[model samples]
Target chain A: MSDDIRKKVFEIIAEQAVLEVSEIAPEHSPQDLGLDSLALVESIFAIEEAFGIEVPFNANAPQQGDFDISSIAAIAAAVERLVAEQRGA
Target chain B: MRRVVITGAGTINPLGHSVSETLAAMRAGRSAIGPLEIRDAGRLSVRIGAQVRDYVAEEHFSRQQLGLYDRFTQFALLAAAEALAQSGLPFPDGRTERAGVVLGTAGGGVGTWDESYRAVYEEGRNRVHPFVVPRLMNNAAAGHVSMRWNLKGPSFSVATACASSNHAMGLAAQMIRAGQAEVMLAGGSEAMLCFGGIKAWEGLRVMSRQACRPFSADRDGMVQGEGAAVFVFEEYEHARTRGAEILAEVAGFAMTSDAADIVMPSREGAARALAGALADAGLAPEQIGYINAHGTGTAANDRTECAAVADVFGAHAGRLMISSTKSMHGHLIGGTGAVELLACIMALREGVIAPTVGYRAPDPECPLDVVPNTAREARVEAVLSNAFAFGGFNAVLALRRA
Candidate 1:
């Protein structure tokens, strides 16, 4: 189920970005996916809503580079980290 | 400072294209809203919009010209032609240098954007249409208006979201006051009723499923609408000297930003604008007779706007006739203020307040005399039209009978 969520998030990112989702490697950043700042923000919203997970990042924060070049695998790891932190895992 | 007055007005709203036809429709208590017809509105929660019908673009512009302009620009040109013709302003021949154009828009070329988006995303086309830039540009309405009428003075576009047209009108008034232009064409046009435009708004999650019910307890949210409304504004003295039929004077104007949330409205911002516009117009709150509320049918906007009016006008708030023409015309977004301002001008001059068409039960939070679903005969000296837009842009225009 969580893998499906990651795939859906990637689909949205692919919608905005010029690159295909399959072309992105797990270690590659979102810039590698050709996502600009606007696309990144939109992807964040799409991911949050798609996964029903709250990532610990401010929407308006300048620290946007913290999620630099986020691939679907990296995004899945980040969500897992956030969910684990919330669950006290 | 020179005074600014409305010398001419034209519109192509859901009600109708001509002033008489629209006024007749309003008087008959007919709602221009129905099911969406622009294509692929089947999936959206809100399928109803106040759309202009029987408008053939090819009839107005040649095929080549149509390729160069967006639907919004086409609407602007058509409405501008009507206004200029009514004003009898001789193509602005001698006053070309001193004449100008300013238009307001929310989603400049939404139809063009939708088509291009399909070409790129669905069709997998890497290259966009060459006319994409010109068709989707926000300034295209102003550019077309300038070109059509040979206006050579200061020309630009004002975009304050839904409040765009009011801001445009207010800025044009300032231009005349500043001696930058002797005559100005100002208003707004919108053509965002496309499939993608409606889908984009659906993401906001604030559209109503039923009809727009301004100030009503059952009000859910705003219905999307499209049209154009333009007004010819001349310096008060210039209009009088030219023997122009004065519609109304642009008495006062004020603009304020909430500087807060993008979607949430602020009562303080609205209240300050009301007081500021009154002060700018050199009129007392008591003297103002009618108010055309922004009244987008959103729960937050209606409540906040009601509180603002009550705060600013005190006892006068209860006594004054207030209505949301959006109830009938639907929310035209960028063009809403201009169309509503025309309604305000006519209300002040004709001494009749348009009804809030879909009003049924009044919201307890918005407990004011919203004139309630029926046009009322009353003596109106001055009228106020309030327009609040997305991202906290708020503009108000005060108009008085000539």
Candidate 2:
């Protein structure tokens, strides 16, 4: 189930970043993947739509947000946790 | 070229129902933003707004007029009436062919659209109101104002998203200055607190559930507000001949488009408008004593506005006092600039500068003196009011003390 969520996240990010799924590595930063503000927002929206969940975005402090984007892996990990919490709820 | 001056002003906003009341609220450091009292509040992620509370439409308008008039139009007519009464215009003699109106409204009858859409889509109804088209048209308020005042010259509405009112007022002043009109009633009104309107803005993700603290480091985002403000911008000689009390001299105005991003603001574009207005007025940067900043509380806007001010004003930037009344009134979007002009008049005419009430922490990016949390008695010789819209429209107006 965790791998499925990670794969979905990577696919969504690849589509938003205008890159192939294979080009997206777990360690790459969003900037390294060439994602601008609009692209990043679109990726978040796609993830929310796919998981049927809401993501909390903060101003001036991305680390404090519910979804961490230090790297692609961090985002996947956060999404996995949020999806798990949603299922439990 | 003739000089343009403001002779009359009226408003019905979150701060107050009249200019005196609104100025009084600003003097006491009052913020009217609170929990938004509207339908479907439970479904909305953000519910706090600066709404005009305790207003009953029936008390102000007849039932027949309400049928044709949207909430935005109603607010405009009320404000226009007050302003005309103050200006003593359309005098006992008669209306002039050189008189007209130019009002701004982003969503003219947004409330009517929201209600009709709900009736047809959500409630599964087919037929809607027959007057929906006229009510929802963007120029409805402007048309009604012109007809009511018997203004026969150039009259129209401007819709540049957030900078609508500033553009309208600037154009009106330009018309008067060019000798095309002698008297033009200008300003803006907005009543977009309906569910559809809020929901549409929510998609932009630039709203804050908390307070709007512009120029503050920890500020999150902008809070929405609603209402209208109208002013009579007349030729200086015309106003003087008619024995009208001049509120402030509309010294100079300039507008520019970024032509860049759809949502993001450009610093160079904003700086151009500021500098252009000063050059138009032939006033040096040192002459501007106060500025009502387009401080929308968003991180990008505050930083960019400060940078623009710094770019245009140079060393004088540090000396000038700047504040965002949005902290108290919320972001009215289209109607914001017109309502904010009142702050400029108050600062120039009354020597009272309204404070940015929600400011807590200082932002290094915005190092200018932001009159924070309390009103100050400072005699300002000249002032500038700024409005930078989402679509990269920048409008700046310079006003001198009357």
Candidate 3:
């Protein structure tokens, strides 16, 4: 289920943004993936709306070092964590 | 200085072809937005646009004549014909040499470009259509209007992204004021509801998957629309002499540049333009009854425009009837303000205000009362039409009852 959700999430990001998931790895931040602050907010909205899960919003979730939203792997992991939280809740 | 007034109006929008048809559609709250019918829209996430359907060049122009014109040019010719018919102004005879034509367009001949590129890149065709350059030129519409009407004076086109038509009207007004022409055919035309056009807008990242819902909290982004709206502007005396039915006076206009950013809007820039237009019209904010907003259904634009309105009108901003007709017509880009200006003229003359179609929820950031979803009846005095373009080109025009 998380993988399927991740696939959808990656599709939206791939369609909207120029960077690819493989291009940005575990080391790169989402910002480095070129999801500007605004795009990040919008992406967050799209993800939550798409997956029916709320991302755990730590004050620094957006501020973590080298957060890579460009890579499908990173986005899937983030989405997986969020989905787990929603289910745990 | 001479005065300028709208002596005639014409349109071919998603609603219909005539001015009355479009106005009726707006009053009925019927949005012209629908599924794309032009090309293979399968790849696009957003598959809707306000397309002018069944508009065939062969039906309107002869093949030989059509060879010299693009879709934009054909639309301009038809719209100008309608405007001239409404104005009951025959070609000005020898005096036609003094009449001018100014048109606004953003995409020019984007359809032609798209087809040519496909032929060369995908089909590997070595030869392109010879009409490509003439058809694709941004000034083709103006040139066609000039040729169709025998207009000779000060003919040109102005392009300032979405603000194109408002700028054209402002310039036309100035030309009339300066006695450069006795009559001017002014407005804008766009036929960019093509594959290439939509692809170009995709790069902007602001297009909504659903319909445009300007000033709505749930609004995603703008829907593309295609059409032309033209106005016959004449010196007050010339129109009166010809017994033409005057619509609304081009009372005053103002323009400003943001100089801040290419894409983002500035409240300071918008406020200055709004204030300048009011000042130019020699009217106070309280006297203005309606405003056609440049609400592009984007988060940034609506909030910025709302804040700018609040900053300028204070409490009166709430009282003023404001709506973004783009909700119904979609964003015509360069032609939007011109077509929307027609709505303003209709409101002033008929004493009714059109509503912002597709407006559902109230946006917290955009606190303005955008006459939501339903057309309202009011004795409007003056209307202001605002257009803010991509590169921070801001233009405001104040139209009053003639």
Candidate 4:
């Protein structure tokens, strides 16, 4: 389940960045991958749609969100946790 | 004080997609207002609108650009591109740093908002598009234009309902006259012909279902339109130095407020704006030969505007050739004045007066010489473009032959 979530996360970010999934490194932040504010927001939206789970991200203050977005790995782990919690509920 | 002149003009209204096409349509006295073309047309009471037909998003913008640009921003950018190309004043070296963009739009991205809201409420969707906020904001059009042209100077958007474009053009001219910017891309755009946009206006009952017959006794109400018009307002000296083809001189502009009813038209406010514009231009009433009236085709606005024109021009009102191009293009709301200014420019530059196309019978309340249903060939030295908004906001601009 976590692997599936990770793969989906990288695909979504790659789509937003207009890059191949292989090009997106797990350690790289969205900015390091040339993802603008618009791209980041779209990635978040796509993640929510794919997982059917809401990610606590605010466009006005993106860094203050509960979901960690420091790197692609962090975003993937956050989505995994949210999906697990939703399944348990 | 510096002088400002229109170096270039571009528009995409119902009449035409280009300035040249629009001019030809005006000369032929063609009506662009026709059957509505929007989603859920069967549900709307006001089905007709003057929409930009056959507009394909992919043809005008890239996929990346389409993600950020709403229909209104697209219209503005397209119009601005044409205007800039016509001006031929390339922002070379550091000249781009001092140029700016000022636009007027009442609904900005109302289409985006309406679609997103419908998704959540009507379609029972939980998530909306991520770029919805940025796309729907009122300043989106202005911001996109500034970014596209690399205009780093003063940039903003105005929302004065129907008078928005007049206020924007007037303020842009003042920026040039005050020496704040060497050049300013000024105009307005609107894309409020969507289901939600028309539904909201239907409540006001100021919509004409059939035709927009301004100043005619059988006039019912206004027909909505969606499009844009943009112009290059440059300092006269700068344009002259560049040997740019000057379109027309933006002689003067004035704005006034009634401070009365929010929805009703004010003769006092309109008259004051007309008088103030002439005074600002330092031209007597007799010097002005034509007027492009607000003429919303609504009974109240047509009557009030005519009374105000008579009050200000008096005897000259009878001699001046006054007509409403809105009769052909339909009311573009916030963007209406910018498109109507084309009529004034045509009058001054081409010596062609665009006629009010759908005139049936004139009412005594509006007794001015409305050039009815036929374009007139006349060598007018100066012209006035009037715009009156719902909140008693009035803005009038004067232009002269280059």
Candidate 5:
């Protein structure tokens, strides 16, 4: 389930960046992958929709949002944790 | 003081898509108000609107441009292009830095907001477009125009409800008079004929479901319209030096606040604006030949406007021609004043008076010579365009033959 979530997250991020999923490495920064602030927010929205979980996002202070967006792996990990929490709740 | 003159004009309203087409339609006294073709029209109580029919975004803009340009921005760009082309005043070398853009719009990108909000709230969709913020900003149209024209001077947008375009044009002329800019692209645009735009106005109960018949006895209310009009306002000397064909002189402008009611029209405030405009133009009330009234087809607006005209112009009001083109083009809200300025230009330059169509029964209160149902040919030296917004904001502009 965790692998499936990570793969889906990478696909969504790649789509936003207008790149192939194979080109987006897990360790690469979303910004390095051409996801600007606007595209980053869109990726977060897509993640929230795919997982049916809320991802905190502040347009003014994006880095301080509850969701970690430092890199593709970090975002996937955060989404996985939120999904687990929602299931447990 | 520097004098400002209109060198070029363009418009894309319900009546037509260019200045020539719109003026021809006005000359024919044609009505553009008809059934609304917007999405979800069956759900709206107001089913009629003056929409700019046959406008396709894909035909004018590329995919990348369309992603950033909202409907209002597109309208402004189209109108601006025509105005600039007609002016033939090439911003040569350093002159580009001295030109600016000032546009008015009440709902800058409400259509974009409406679609995104509906997607997230009603359709249960989480992901929306990435450029939504840039697309929905109130200054988006101004910013795009500035970037396109390389206008590095003062560029901004004004939002004063229905009087926005008048305020914008007035301010742009002031900038030229104050030596801030040599040339300014001034006008306004609106695209609030969407589902959400009409739905919100439904609460106000001021919309007409049938047609807009301003200053008529059987008039119900104002109908909404969408489009844009743009003009090139240049220093009179600069235009003369370049051999540009001057359309009309923007002689004077005055704005007065009612400070009385939020929605109801005030006779005192309207009269003050009319008087102030005449004073600013250094002309007597009797010198004016025509007046494009701010007749919204509402009972309150028509009566109060007539009383104010009587108070200010007195006996001269009976002699001058007073008409409301809103009866034909409907009301463009923030963009209405800019479009109505076309009628004033026609009256001043071409000796043509656009009529107030859809006149059914005569209202004794509005007893002015409203050129009803047919266009009349008359030589008018000067005209005034009146725009009174909701919130008691009044702005009147004076124009004279060039």
Candidate 6:
């Protein structure tokens, strides 16, 4: 995982959650970070748009999907993998 | 207070273009959801919608009419014509003064708005069509239905998102009950299957790409549908004097607001509306045999609605036959409740319960009998229709067998 990717994802999530970047921690879950459904969805969209890769996630089946949204660090790692795969393809 | 009864019903929906056609499709448990045929379908992640197929505007309207009628208005007009014909009401006559039109739509002329925006932003057009305002107005459908039939009493449109139709019909029934009007053409219509409509919903990320499977454990989200359903809601005595065919009685109606989160549903608010409707109809929980659920196939809605039904009906909720016709026709958004009302009518009049098609697995959270995947024959004296909108607006209508 790249720090650049993690930092960018944190920035997007922080913006949607209306919190400072420094206030967020990689171990914090979306719920723990206090992201509502709308905010969570916006964070995903912003992350996708920033990374130029589709994040395969459904709000209803968030737990079933391959994208690990269990924590902020997990989401960033998934985004790193998606970016690498999309660029390689 | 006057009694309200449905003397006629008409619909041009994904299931069919007529009442008989719709009932037959519902009986057969057919699904109309399919691939999108609109412009920029490839651009959308969610490409499926329950669209009114084989629709040709030129066959139904003239060139001048097409210029003024958006897709939503066209569906409303067609359904209204069929309903009025079935009702056998000669408009612009002596009785016309006591008749009115009240219809509903979530996004009025969404396609027109999309086209106009594209013309200005994408194509760089300096100006749009002169009739664009009239074509896309929210009241365009109701206004046209009123003018076309010369309904002079009261005519307007309601836009409470998904609950628009139920609210419109409920208000129409209230008007007749209060002696404000003897007859009303009440229902709803929506044509938001275009590029703009789906694109906007796509942003919300609440749409499913494949199907709308309400109550199914694997259900992802709702699929959008398009069409209109209109009915002739006439005073009982007025209908009887004319020897009109009575479909069902609009026995009770109740509405409530959650005042909670705009998107998330409140179980207490939904339960209050359900209990209120049953109480208004002077019927106990056990008297109600069927409920056309506001099951949008979303996890949040199905779970909350089931919880509400369970809370309202108690042990009787398990005995009640509740189904979501949206599984077959998809969520029509504003016009959905009107189309779902037809299912309630079928339950009361024909002893047929429409199935919630596309059910694969059951979710434990939704423990009630969902009448999954297959239509059933059941005799019921009364049934209820539920519509809860995005803004936490809840409206439920109860109907009695005629």
TM-score (0 to 1) for chain A, all models?
A: 0.64, 0.91, 0.62, 0.93, 0.93, 0.93
lDDT (C-alpha) at residue A54 in model 3: 54
Displacement of residue B383 (Cα, Å) in model 2 is: 0.4
Candidates' DockQ values?
A: 0.04, 0.45, 0.08, 0.01, 0.01, 0.67
List pairs with backbone clashes in candidate 2: none
Per-residue lDDT tens digits of candidate 3, residues B48-68? Answer: 899887666688788888877
Model 1 chain B worst lDDT window (10 residues): B201-210
lDDT of 4 by residue, B228-260 (tens): 999999999999998999999999999999998
TM-score of chain A of 1: 0.64
lDDT per residue for candidate 3 within A12-64, as digits (tens), equals 66545676655545555555667664566567667777878654321112323
Considering summed lDDT, which 10 consecutive residues are worst modelled in model 5 chain B?
B201-210
Q: Which parts of model 4 are misplaced by more than 4 Å?
A: A1-89, B92-94
Error of 4 at A13 (Å): 59
User: What CA RMSD would you report for each candidate?
Assistant: 9.0, 1.3, 6.5, 18.3, 16.9, 1.2
Candidate 2 — number of clashing residue pairs?
0
Please, what's the RMSD in Å of model 4? 18.3
Ranking of all candidate structures by their lDDT, best first? 6, 2, 4, 5, 1, 3
What lDDT score goes with residue B62 in model 2? Answer: 89
Task: Tell me the TM-score that candidate 5 gets on chain A alone.
Answer: 0.93
lDDT of each: 0.84, 0.91, 0.84, 0.90, 0.89, 0.92
TM-score of each: 0.83, 0.98, 0.85, 0.81, 0.81, 0.98
Q: Provide the TM-score of the second chain in candidate 1.
A: 0.98
The most accurate candidate by DockQ is 6
- Model 1 TM-score is 0.83
**Stronger candidate by DockQ (1 vs 4):** 1
